[model samples]
Target: MTLDTWTTRLSRSLLVNGLPREYVCRTTREMADHLEDMRDSEGDDDASRRLGDPDTLAQMLTHGFRRQSLFGRHPFLTFWLSPIPIATFLAHIVYLFTIELIMPVVVRLYGESEVAFVSGSLDATKVVLVLAMHLWLQAIPVLLTMRLYRIIASRAARPWTSIIPAMILFLLYFSMTKFELTWPSGTNPGNYRIDIGTVSGFSSQPVTQGLQALFVALVCILWLYRVAGEQSSERESAVTAIP
Candidate 1:
């Protein structure tokens, strides 16, 4: 196979097996460059044989990947949040629909002033608020999913064990732009023009979403810690009284 073809297969396999995107991209880029140069000087036959199977290469990369993960101890939890990027895409689509369709109808019924606000160019402040609010709504389901996963994972380990996966997913979700899901088309949630300064800008929705996720995580972690501490105290007191 050509260097490009081999690299493509290796990249796909590593990504499919749940290597973090940053690590996968960086590692694959270096591997591809090295292989391409090797093929250039040494020819295809030796490089192909030495590299062995692309599948095996991906497995070796991913086996080492697991060792480096924040949630390395809980493979199931890491696997559990594997689909979160897809979920983020789906949720954003839903958010877009609600803002585009239902919101217009609701504003129309309110009054002419509100109707104008809906149709007219929004100022920076309003656009910021709108985007932040919409993103929060989109993030609600994700937060619930995280919490539920933590509850389920508590049986296997401490509840906080689930937070790393949830936090990683949250970071990925918040880091992405409209490009991830709607690069060339579709209405971007925050990519509207603000009337205040005639400024067209991407909204601070990502930061808002990050803050929301962090808040939820903090609350859950502290709550779990407090409960565990209380339970530990109770167990110690009971043991002492029995003695």
Candidate 2:
């Protein structure tokens, strides 16, 4: 192919491989300029030979864009924070509405909490349910964050880095959900009582919510790593299977 044709091919290939349009435009222009400059240094044949074919070059670029270093993964939350994961964010909104529907049933089943719970009030059990549900809502953010990272990480990158967001999200949810306080109730004029407990550690409660969140974060990290690893394996197998 001619130089222009080759550049066009590379540009199209990069676009097809999911690169952003602006990036593709800028990159293709720079590459074309470089090729034009080198056109005189050696014959077109030698230059083409050195640069390789459009298909090969595009594949190499795609590979580089996809791969990320393991250590850089922890602090690489920028992309996760940007672009707004629309699908997953919408899913979380759906989840919010779903909770509105489902929690009433959950409360009705848990205790005589339906009336208070549905009306946007909280007794001890209702409060626990709300907190737990908030924690569950965290799944959306972590799941979306995982997907975003997966797009950038290489197949052989081991998916170990996805653990960071998963763990952080888990701790965030866990800390918010972990509730410790005393509930005062008076059933008779002369008698009063203090009730205390949590959803899990109803007794022997931990004093610090951070400690509980940290433990939960560990669990989240382990689970996320296993899940991401399995998914990466399956994807690789599928790609390999594509003849």
Candidate 3:
């Protein structure tokens, strides 16, 4: 099949699988083409092999997109180039409940007790560094998503109202998983405790946490709805203005 044909089919496939169609067409199609070319090159020596089988080609293309590490010349590129709206509604719902709700609640319930620590300048510096990492981790995904929205739909530029919700959701997830993973593994001296407990919950009470998280999630959903509306309107206006 021709390159355009393959891209169009693959684009449709991704859409059916719940990715945003326009984005897969614009951002990911080129990568698919490139991977196809690489596979063709590799398969050139095998005269009997069909290099462009659609099923195999699609799998390779999707894998490349997922495994792409945007270091070196394209440092930090994945944040923008990720397949947007990549998850199905069911998958997103599952993620929301497990990562955003259940895990955070579990971590907070079991991990918040006080622990003894040594006092020193080194310890203080370690604490600061860990806190900084947590802050950056929380901020990067939201900031990147906003930046991607601007790049993808430039005409619909507006501050993302979804950030508050994503943040709240992340905090819920963060509180549950952070310390349980970061605590020191042994009685090693001069070590800092990267406790998940340090992450303040949305609220101490589970019910209160859920309510606050829901508010943030509502803000996010509304913002996303507005964004989709603005993009659609912009596209319509452009089409009307076309000669």
Specify the highest-TM-score model's number: 2
- State the lDDT of candidate 3 residue by residue for 93-141, as single tens digits: 4444544554445435444322322222234445555445444433333
**Model 1 Cα lDDT, one tens digit per residue, 171-190:** 44543423111122335332
Worst 10 residues of 2 by lDDT: 188-197
Best of the two (2, 3) by TM-score: 2
Instruction: Please give the TM-score that candidate 3 achieves against the real structure.
Output: 0.29
**On residues 121-240, what C-alpha lDDT tens digit does candidate 2 reach at each position?**
336765666556544544444455556555544332323454455345434543443344334346421211111112444234555455555555655666676866775565444333
Query: 1 or 3: which has the higher TM-score?
Result: 1
lDDT of each: 0.53, 0.52, 0.41
Clashing residue pairs found in predicted model 1: none
TM-scores of all candidate predictions against the true structure: 0.37, 0.41, 0.29
